[model samples]
Target: MRQPRKSTVEIRTSFRGREAIVSGAAAALFRREKEGGFFGISVKLHARVRLKVIVVNSVEYRPDVDCYIRVPDPSNATAVAQGFAPRRCHVDDFS
Candidate 1:
């Protein structure tokens, strides 16, 4: 397993207060803390001037696949609250 080097991400995710383990990104040698379905990373972009990029929304992960996926609105608390939890699947439900 690869640990994050000087690079890391930590977000306070709360699904009844728990953690989102990013074993998938771990392959990419990146580790992060997931909370409210968001992970924060600290990086340095050296430039004569300054550069700023922004993430204005939430992030979600799929532990079943060990990766992050895009969602319409990650701010859905009831859904995002499933961090590090077993997914509730229905045989009739397919998305």
Candidate 2:
């Protein structure tokens, strides 16, 4: 007999100091898989600049894992416009 797949929950949160909320699956929050990768949320801040936010699960071999939000710095709009990498923001697990 084969084991059943685990059920996933929806996670929603707003970017650092942003009004928009990004939502994704609980299992593959910020992981990229070969079979079914989690899709990231995209938001446009300026006329020529857009940002993508994803929740990355960085726990290895652990029962309780922590998640983080990867997004561009809202304060550094000019740097983001100049094509810089997004920073990782820590997420608090209240459950």
Candidate 3:
């Protein structure tokens, strides 16, 4: 069998409620178009990259600033792991 080709997209997201960074590699984020030229991209983050996490709520230290982070989807992860980033590693196993 052949591994499916992967696509990478950078997504700055807030996880667990705190200002954190998570790099994810995704397989597919299907898109659909609607009337009036409206579209949506559904992204399911990859699970290979190690991430720093935090948890917060509307009561405890609510964040007002938008955070920025890198995404390492299979393709991006493969790229980064293959010395694509400034400093890179080999993505042998994202397990």
Candidate 4:
């Protein structure tokens, strides 16, 4: 069992518009604590990143296999966004 960390994350799918609204990535971890407290690690996903992954299904699908879909990447992209200026804006005007 790994210790869970507190962090906020938002995962979105690229295939269509599906999304997993999680309070924190740590909530996804499943573990037991020796002192009776649960422990896990959380993942902080970026707001602009997307990712495509296979997710396992239960009851209707096989446990060994799973389905996949495009989702938001778990990395920060604010810097990238800041670097790009609006299409209407003139690059030379800033200077």
Which model scores highest in TM-score? 2
Best by lDDT: 2
TM-score per candidate, in order?
0.19, 0.21, 0.18, 0.15
Off by over 4 Å in 3: 1-62, 76-78, 82-95
> What would the per-residue lDDT of candidate 4 be over residues 16-53, giving only the tens digit for each residue?
33664354653343212212232222223222222223
RMSD of 1: 20.4
Error of 3 at 1 (Å): 46
Q: Root-mean-square deviation of each candidate, in angstroms?
A: 20.4, 19.5, 19.3, 22.5
* Model 1: per-residue Cα lDDT over 1-95, one tens digit each: 23344666654543352564446765334222323344433322221222233534333322221223322225557546654432332232111
Tell me the spans in candidate 2 whose CA falls farther than 4 Å from its real position.
Answer: 1-7, 15-62, 68-70, 78-95
Model 3, span 17-57: residue lDDT tens: 35433333321221112121222323333332223234432
Using lDDT as the measure, name the better of candidate 1 and candidate 4: 1
**Candidate 4 Cα misplacement greater than 4 A, ranges:** 1-32, 49-95
**Residue 15 lDDT in model 3?**
36
lDDT of 2 by residue, 46-75 (tens): 112122235443333212333332343334
